[model samples]
Target chain A: MSMPKGSNIGQFVVIEEGVKLGENVTIGHHTVILKDTVIGDNVTIGCNCVVGVRKSRNQNMRISNSSLDPLVIQANCKIGNHVSIYSGTTIAQDVFIADHASIRENVEVGPGTIIGRGAIIELNTKIGHDCTIQTLAYVTGDTTIEDHVFIGPCVSMSNDKYMGAREYTLKGPYIQEGAKIGNNATLLPGITIGSSAVVGAGSVVTKDVADFKTVVGSPAKDIRYLVSKEVSEHDTTT
Target chain B: MSMPKGSNIGQFVVIEEGVKLGENVTIGHHTVILKDTVIGDNVTIGCNCVVGVRKSRNQNMRISNSSLDPLVIQANCKIGNHVSIYSGTTIAQDVFIADHASIRENVEVGPGTIIGRGAIIELNTKIGHDCTIQTLAYVTGDTTIEDHVFIGPCVSMSNDKYMGAREYTLKGPYIQEGAKIGNNATLLPGITIGSSAVVGAGSVVTKDVADFKTVVGSPAKDIRYLVSKEVSEHDTTT
Candidate 1:
């Protein structure tokens, strides 16, 4: 392990073999950084965090078990207390992961994203830059979220429609750029939320949304088409 | 601090002054037990837990600041890893609080309850015996949940109807015994869910539900009245 010259580490931190830290990295008490992990310059990790945790296999699930790459945390990221980031994940520069959040293996989080408190990001997900996933939201496995998307608090997304009752392919929602999903909304499996679309609070979306559309209610229907690109951009992405 | 006979505490554990542990307790690595906490016989607490945390008041919220009593964990309780339990709370016997769960101050959880992984129980809630609050559920402040109740995953409950827009009384839902709220359901403020009532998955509950009724959909309406107490009991409570 090679520690940077200006790195500041708190008491009881465990930096394992083959781990690398860049300049001015700050880590709080009781944090454990596993072997082969890479942290870029000026990263801040809070107390009791476990970085580069290996993904556990379940006997009931038949997911593939390929050799995973080491975790990578880019420069200027701030990870809060009690956060858990698994191995094979890549967190880009300037991201903020709030307290008690969990990010699973094989995930990629782009630059300048904010993962809110207690949110759960499942395995194999990819989130683009400048996104905001608010508190307690569950972004399920295999999802792709584009840049500047705002996902409200407690939003739930599913990847399996059969929910383990039958053997089915796992495919989560594909949310396009600048879309906004409101609080407590449920997005069913394999749905595509188009660019600049707005999903209303507590809605249960069952179909694909069109670009510049606003949808509300269960089996979410299009309430109105956003009149112009400027109007849609002002209402959602901003 | 007084450790009981046959107590098994892991490395890097911090047991503060005035904390008391009973017979055969097992505490995992890096767990912190604050002052004046009392743990009874045969309890098992997992790694990286913060037990007996004091509540932090926000400058924006006008809530009373009374002196809190010490935390109490009764016999045979199982608390999982990364859990955060606040002071002035009492967890009764045989309770199972899963990993990453957060329980706030002045809460009361009765015997044989199961608080699932990533569940959030806000302050001043009272949950009765033999209940099951499932994963990612958000039980807001000042709520009351009676015995044998089942709250499903990602179920969200609100206490303030105004949602910070205006001043109003904060009163969460009063869920009676054996009520089952399904996955992704949203319970609005101040509503009463009657005994053995069933709120279906993804439902938005706005009004009070009658006893033995089954409600579904947004602005949930009664789908059917359960024929008898035996039928409702068999379907929900059991």
Candidate 2:
């Protein structure tokens, strides 16, 4: 194999043949880039991160594993160290995945989304563009998060009514466009947060939340109506 | 620094000055043993695991970054691959730490304890000998788990009550000896599980459990008496 002139490759990096590496892609020490993984231009992969590694063969466990699908991170995305993006996850252009975040298999994160540090997105979730999933929040399986939504820190989204035992007939909950979920909130399965709705912090959402309304408390009740137009006008003036 | 004859060194593993490796110790690929981290004889470190790496310089993240503590895995302990045993975690002899488990700073696992795969034992939590923590369980800060305790999979032991904007003191919980917690259970803070008590699956324990009692349901109540003597006699006869 011929060497590239003036390229700094760290120790323990396995750059397999046919894997494309963009210019100025700096992989840190002890990081492993497996075969068939593609890196875009100017990507900074930090120390001890594993990219393109195969998932562990243990099926009975639900802990984070490397994805089998081809992971594609678009140009100019900032991926922090210790971030494990499982297989079949496609990070769109200009996305920022913070440190210690775990994105499971087959997730389609749209462009301009910012996944906060230590946030866990379970398998098969589809997040739309420009969304912000905050720190320490958990979005469980098969949830659909629309574009421009804001999920606060430590918010929990559940997929099964019975925790990991009874599978729900329907898929998990859906959060429509422009909705905001507060910190430490819980969203039950089969529920929906309507467009522009607001869920209060520490609320356990047991039912659907109507659009432009703010709900709070356990088994969350509608507290007040938030006028979207008035808020937009206030935003425009400010 | 003179090279010893017939020494087997794995690729990308850096053994700095003053570090000692006993004979027949197998260092897997990409595993870094930093300065002054000692490995006993007959130790087997799996692949892609980082030992004695410097901590990230984040101060307020609840993760202790000072490497003032050295990780000492005693002889004959079987540590699985991809396990991150941070600084200050001491694994006694014959301890079995499974894959993907995170033993954070200042934690100690007694000998013959099997920490299940993907279990997160937070800082300052001391797990006694012969205890089995099941997969995906989270044992948080300052908690003490005594000997022969079985914490089931995905069980969450919380440290805070009156959560989310409530002004309450956050106290630690205690799990006494020979307790068994079923899968997906939640234990509130400051509550003690008496010796040989059994908490059923999917139960949320809000109060202390009495010794040799069986508890079930949400906000778990006492269901029946756990016949400890009878069970012990059956075990002896078998």
lDDT of 1 by residue, A130-215 (tens): 99999989898889999999999989887766433358888989999999999989887799999999999988887899988899
For model 1, residues B1-238, the per-residue Cα lDDT tens digits are: 5667999987688999889899999987688999888999999887788999877778895442421788999999988778899888899998988678899888899998888678999988999998888668899999999998988778889999998999898999999998888768899999999998988768889999999888877788777542354487788956
List per-prediction Cα lDDT, in the order shown: 0.85, 0.71
Q: Model 2 in CAPRI terms: which quality? A: incorrect
DockQ of predicted model 1: 0.19
How much does each candidate deviate from the true structure in C-alpha RMSD?
Answer: 8.7, 11.1
lDDT tens digits, residue span A63-147, model 2: 3343656777776666654567765677787687755578877788997788865578887789998887865579988899999
In model 2, the runs with Cα more than 4 Å from the true position are A1-9, A15-30, A34-48, A52-83, A86-138, A141-171, A175-189, A193-238, B1-18, B22-24, B57-60, B65-67, B160-172, B225-238
Every prediction's TM-score for the first chain? 0.91, 0.83
Candidate 1 docking classification: incorrect
What does candidate 2's lDDT look like per residue over B105-183, in tens digits? 6788988898888676766778999999998676766788999999999676655443322466545469999999998
